[model samples]
Target chain A: AQSVAQPEDQVNVAEGNPLTVKCTYSVSGNPYLFWYVQYPNRGLQFLLKYITGDNLVKGSYGFEAEFNKSQTSFHLKKPSALVSDSALYFCAVRDMGSGNTPLVFGKGTRLSVIA
Target chain B: SAVISQKPSRDICQRGTSLTIQCQVDSQVTMMFWYRQQPGQSLTLIATANQGSEATYESGFVIDKFPISRPNLTFSTLTVSNMSPEDSSIYLCSVVPGQGAVGYTFGSGTRLTVV
Candidate 1:
């Protein structure tokens, strides 16, 4: 079984400041980690993913995530937050060994970029 | 990346009525999935919509209540039967463009409100 945990339900950050949303996972095998954003009344947009190779992965809308194997974490980050960037962020994971398995998503973290 | 178009962006239905959500992909995809996102909650995989085969549902979800149809590789539908207030949620369809793809593309969700 594989599962993802987003420790924070909501994160507040000032505009122009760095923002971080924490995510961690548990899986039997290597994990394929992903981050997605959902704006109000809209579908989810893919942000980035960590399958193999580099520990740091950059994504859409100036967002990035660091995949730390030792910590079992893939935390989303933005160098400078923007008010427009506020949205519901989700962290998902699928077992790389489990062929074509559906992704398991973490309870979403709502990010609020305060101006 | 594949583009998906989902219909019935939002709907208000009477209890006991059914709603069918449709998704059409621009490109052929190997894996398609349906997910439910309850208010302020994480996404839950409803089923894997297999082309030309019965959908494989996750635990706590039954085929009778949530019937799925994937007649071909580019299209799929999910019908919510005997709708109730508990069934009010955002339904989303996702697809993997090809095997070993790092990210999956999602459609604009269908929001169902049962009254």
Candidate 2:
């Protein structure tokens, strides 16, 4: 079985400042991790993913995530937060060894970037 | 990434009624998944639909209450059966185009409000 956790329900950051949303996972096999953002009245947009290769991966909208194997974490980060970045972020994970396994999601972290 | 079209975008239904949300993908996808997101909450996997098989539902979800259909690779539907006020939520559909796809493409989501 695979599961994900986002410890914080909300993260507040100032515009132009850095922001980090934490995520952790528990999986028996290698994990395929992903980050998605849901803006108001819009579908979720893919942010980034960490499947293999580099531990750090860059994604759309200048967002990035670091895959920490030791910590079992894949935290989403942005160098400079913007007011537009205020939205709900979700971290998902699936077991790589399980063919077409459905992704399990965390509780999510709501990001609020103030002007 | 696959482009998904889902609708009715938002609906308000009377209690004990039902609503069927459809998802059409631009490209062929072997698996389609249905998820539910409550207001101000995270997402939860409801089921996985394959073209020729019945949907495999996650724990706490049942096929009778949330029937799914996948008659082809690019199209699927999920019906909210005998809905009650508690069934109001944002229902989303997602799919992976093929192998080597790291992240799932999601539909804009259907906001169902059971009154």
Candidate 3:
């Protein structure tokens, strides 16, 4: 079975400061990791994904994530947080060997960019 | 990437009534899925919508209570039967667009409130 854990339920960061939301996963085989954002009353928007390449992956809205295999983590990051960046962020993972399997998501982390 | 349009963005229904949420994709997709996001909770996979067969439901979810219909490749529907307060949540539809490894695309979501 594959599972993801977002250690923080909420993260507060000042605007223009770097923000980081932690995520870690457990899977039997190789993993496919992803990050998504959901604004108020809106659908989830894809941020970025880590399949099988570079350790660092950049995504939409000036967000990026680093996939650390040794640590079994994929933490979302932003160089400079914006007030609009505040939203619910989710980290998801699936076994790469498990073909077409549904993604197992973390509990989610609420990011608050304080002005 | 494929675009998805979901109907009934938000609804308030009486207990015991049913609500059917629809998802329409702009292009053909191989894999479509339904998920539920309870208040302040992570997204849960309800089922995988097969194009011409019965949906494959996840554990703790029954076919009788959450009937799914996938008449074609571009469209699908999920009906919530015998609605209760516990069923009040945001239902979302998602699809694996081109490749299985790429991230999935999601619909705007349907918010159901049972009273």
- Which lDDT tens digits does candidate 1 get at residues A6-93? 9999999999999999999999999999999999989999999999999999999899999999999999999999999999999999
Output the lDDT of residue B18, model 1.
94
For residues B1-83, write the lDDT of model 1, one tens digit per residue: 88899998999999999999999999888779999999989899999988988999999999999999998889999999999
Clashing pairs in 2: none
Where does candidate 3 stray beyond 4 Å?
A: B99-101
TM-score of only chain B in every candidate structure: 0.97, 0.97, 0.97
Per-residue accuracy of model 3 over A59-92 as CA lDDT, tens digit each:
9998999999999999999999999999999999
Candidate that beats the other on lDDT, 1 or 2, i.e. the better one = 1
TM-score pick, better of 1 and 2: 1
* DockQ for the candidates, in order: 0.87, 0.86, 0.87
Worst 10 residues of 2 chain B by lDDT: B96-105
TM-score of each: 0.98, 0.97, 0.98
DockQ leaderboard ranking: 1, 3, 2
Which digits, one per residue and each the tens of the lDDT, describe model 2 over residues A1-115? 7999999999999999999999999999899999999999988888988999999999999999999999999999999999999999999999988877678899989999999
Task: Say which docking band candidate 3 falls in.
Answer: high
Query: Per-model C-alpha lDDT, please?
Result: 0.94, 0.93, 0.94
Residue A114 lDDT in candidate 1? 97
Task: Judge candidate 2 at residue A78 and give its lDDT.
Answer: 92
